[model samples]
Target: MIDQTPLLDQISVPADLRTLQPGQLRQVADELRAATIRAVSQTGGHLGAGLGVVELTTALHYVFNTPDDRLIWDVGHQCYPHKILTGRRDRINTLRQAGGLSGFTKRSESEYDPFGAAHSSTSISAGLGMAVARDLAGGNNHVIAVIGDGAMSAGMAYEAMNNAGAMNSRLTVILNDNDMSIAPPTGAMSAYLSRLLSSKSYLGLREIGKHIAERFPRQFERAVEKAEEFARGFVTGGTLFEEMGFYYVGPIDGHNMDHLLPVLKNVRDAKDAGPVLIHVVTQKGKGYEPAEASADKYHGVAKFDVVTGAQHKPKPNAPAYQNIFGEVLSKLAEKDDKIVAITAAMPSGTGVNLFEKAHPERTFDVGIAEQHAVTFAAGMATEGYRPFAAIYSTFLQRGYDQVVHDVAIQKLPVRFAIDRAGYVGADGSTHCGAFDLAYLCCLPGFVVMAPSDEAELAHMVATAAAIDDCPSAIRYPRGEGTGADLPEVPKVLEIGKGRILREGKTVAILSLGTRLQDALAAADDLAARGLSATVADARFAKPVDTDLIDRLARDHDLLITVEEGSVGGFATQVLDHMTKADLLQTVKLRTLYMPDRFLDQDKPERQVADAGLDAAGIVKTALDALGIESAPDETVSGKDRPARA
Candidate 1:
């Protein structure tokens, strides 16, 4: 029944971990690996990373006094082991399922989690803050931050390191150099690590010098620190972090607890004050054969067979929505020289892979730095290049300030192909593209669109690319699009006009994005109860179709706006516009939007069902609000509903 094996279950807390002998640590690692495999097999989550970090997790928890010494994991993709040891083992079976544990690190989940993270490059800054706070509070606990090398490329990590070095804060950063983040990491930082680790003779000599320096007494120790800094700068061709201020350690074996424990113990006990970074190397998918063989496939997966590691995928003949976006962008770039694509180190995830391949010179991946990605796109637009800033809606939240300041304020024509723009399953609240519509819709002069199907998604992408306005965004969800045949390539949808899906009416439901299916289903069910309701896809969220919205309000007895995202999103924008136009008084208004709570994990449809954003629930809400309630023979828990497959 267990996937990897109980190398983890017998023990519960840090005290149990501390008691394990060095030889037993391997068993613990095995158990952690097995536990993670089993949990993710059932719950469907980011499995490959946790398996990769088993040894590192064991070493950190065993060697360091957790719940006393603080640990912050960047992005938290590699925290499953950390979670298991920190009294979360019992909850592991329910990982990422509805009413289950979150996939990312969450402070509310446990005391040891320290800081919650899903976004990258936040570990260093968060750890620095905790270390500084510990100092001010007179706490002697050591603060450790584990960040992947991919995250190291972000400027904020450097900012924290720079500030921490100057302040001489007691902190340690663990660089988990897997050399990959879904894909091989890019940028100067990744290249430097490769070069540094490649030259063994150079590294060996540097270590020998440090070893000899440790034997020196009193003033000699201070001299050694000074000499080491100069020698490092000279030998390493330039140390980005050490120069900024950090006691540099490693490029060590992250999976070898033998080396990790001693190094971690030394760093924890060392009287040497200020920031220290230990660069530990580990394979992304360490133990499992399939995962190690194809790390990206296992990076984030759905439920799979334990024996073969074969995922149970829904049969979709059509390509994923993101794939459609990428392919179209590639075709566009092939024809147009000015058309370029950019992603925040998420080339594949955001559907810009085609653009990257067809126009590699024009495509830029800024390495998990969304703020830089947005502003960089804005800068590119100024140079007479049309840059499609493709990014996931959740990640784009990081660039809100830049969007308002650098792009919107300057009126740059940066086309945002906002992928994964609605409820994201398995990865939970941290990954859900909940606030994008609300945030983008409110931005002055910004045009936002949510497509109903693959056809509209293609059209919207073309429309966004063609817009020379301040900024335009077309948000689409994850997974395969509805089986609708796509509209002709480069076909244009009227900028702010929405087409009505149905034309009946006691109630008119204005649907946004893929939730149009839910609206349609609800309308069908409502008709069964002798209630006819119109369904329309309100394609554009911002600069909303006032003429259509007002017409619906005047014609229908009830005007309902349904969206997958939280309330106050596109639906709220509709309300704001309707109120401004004095149209709210025209009809009884009802909005079917997700509740203003961080949604828990479940299948996407399940979460939507629980949140009352699905077909049956939508009908129920609409019927109730319409004061014409009809009792359905049966009802379903969004969770209880059979999955799409």
Candidate 2:
């Protein structure tokens, strides 16, 4: 080992970096980059985006006084470099580990992550808001929002831009146009940015215009500068942002601190109280060959070999839940004329690439526009086309209003194939599918289902299209199934019903989704402890499977509910139903669910353990609630079961 500790050893905080002379900034940048690579290699998190922003991160902290001059990063996946330099160097190795720093920016994590982000296109809006607040409070501190080019494609980004431009808040919006956000970002905003950058006079004229404006007296200078902003549009390819009233700076080379430092210094030092947009273009995975070629591969990865750039081998056999959804949806689309697929700029990430290829005409990528996708699907549904809006459960949070107002209120049959439903390993709280259940369950006439296996996901897709009365959604996890055998053909599962996977005695446990296998293991443990447990895959989290609940509560000793979602989710729904039926006092109850906190980053299993959702946790809870203690040979295995007394 060459011991990278020396490079990482020196960095404790941004204040430490300030101790170095101006010439030493690049040296510190190199050290931060190396430390980031070393740390992320061990932890296996957002490598490419972090790697790409190394110099930019170094330069921002170098030029601007951070924690004071709020530096807000969009999506926060690229915050690793920022985290490393901001006194968190030592905790880098535990990047996404339990109780460690979050992979995304968190308000509570550190002061460095001023405006926390997990979803895309939120930085400019958040930063502008902070800038306005700062002005109201009479604070002189600068506010800078760094957003990716991909994030700009989102309508909210434009909405924020349009408003910020008009308000002329003393804010700096750094557009890190790397042309990628997990995957290649699409839409017209991308093209507009490209054209703005391609204009030869864009940067030069903007600078020249600034000098001329500065030459005149204050009031005349302000009006003249405003006119130049209009004239510069001709020079800078129509300048949409300038028209919106922002002083557009550059589509400068982001990695080049030679370019970055001067521009940042100019922006920071300037008295321009109006919004200043600094468009910096950087390469995704800059300096890292493996990630440079394939940014998506390194976006949010597992432990990988640094030397060969190969991801650590997972157990072979079962397909990931995402892959299953993608493959099955594509195949089904081939057979059904009405079945079309849609993903919001996440073609490959959501496994809609298969659907894109299979049904090329039917496939539509809305480009970071989740709200539009929902409404678009609704329009398609009205035209007699079955649109499957394949979106991640977390990202769908952005489209809640659309789901309720556009889809559910009107009862449009838009099949939502929600991927990454449960505890995603590396991405942490921002990306966790924690709130989907509560949001989805609240909608009337919406048929929502989650599969206990990969096989059931395929069936749910078929079932969603078959229903024309109301909207339907099926949520699944990010990883592989439990190697459960697949059926030869898919079948439509009955809406609002559940399947009994295993039979037990006193305690009945409702497995919300794929957690059924683990529930089975826990049931075996319960039986061994002489507290017989029944396992049932509730299938539908929305409808609550009232029949299953009523029967189980009537027959079993205690009723237990388990789901990999936040509180006010599946268990809460169950409680509401049980209360509605006046069965609250009729049954002893327990619920194994995620807590009411922003559970930080960790592996899926570790998070489950941390949240008390593991097999041992389940067993302990069941034992405690049932008033059973001091059992014998009480280990839960996948295969064997104890005698069911």
What are the RMSDs of all candidates, in order? 7.2, 5.8
In the range 11-105, model 2's lDDT, one tens digit per residue, is 68887776666777776777777777777878888888888888899889988898898999999999998998887877878887877888888
What's the TM-score of each model vs. the native? 0.88, 0.88
> For candidate 1, what is the lDDT?
0.81
**Error in Å for residue 476 of model 2:** 1.3
lDDT assessment of candidate 2: 0.80
Positional deviation of residue 335's Cα in model 2 after best superposition, in angstroms: 1.3
Stretches of model 1 off by over 4 angstroms after superposition: 1-9, 180-226, 233-238, 295-297, 631-645
TM-score of 1: 0.88
Scanning candidate 1 in windows of ten residues, the lowest lDDT window is 636-645
Candidate 1 per-residue C-alpha lDDT over 212-283 given as tens digits, one digit per residue, 9 for 90 to 100: 878888688778767767766554433667778876665567776666766677677665436877767788
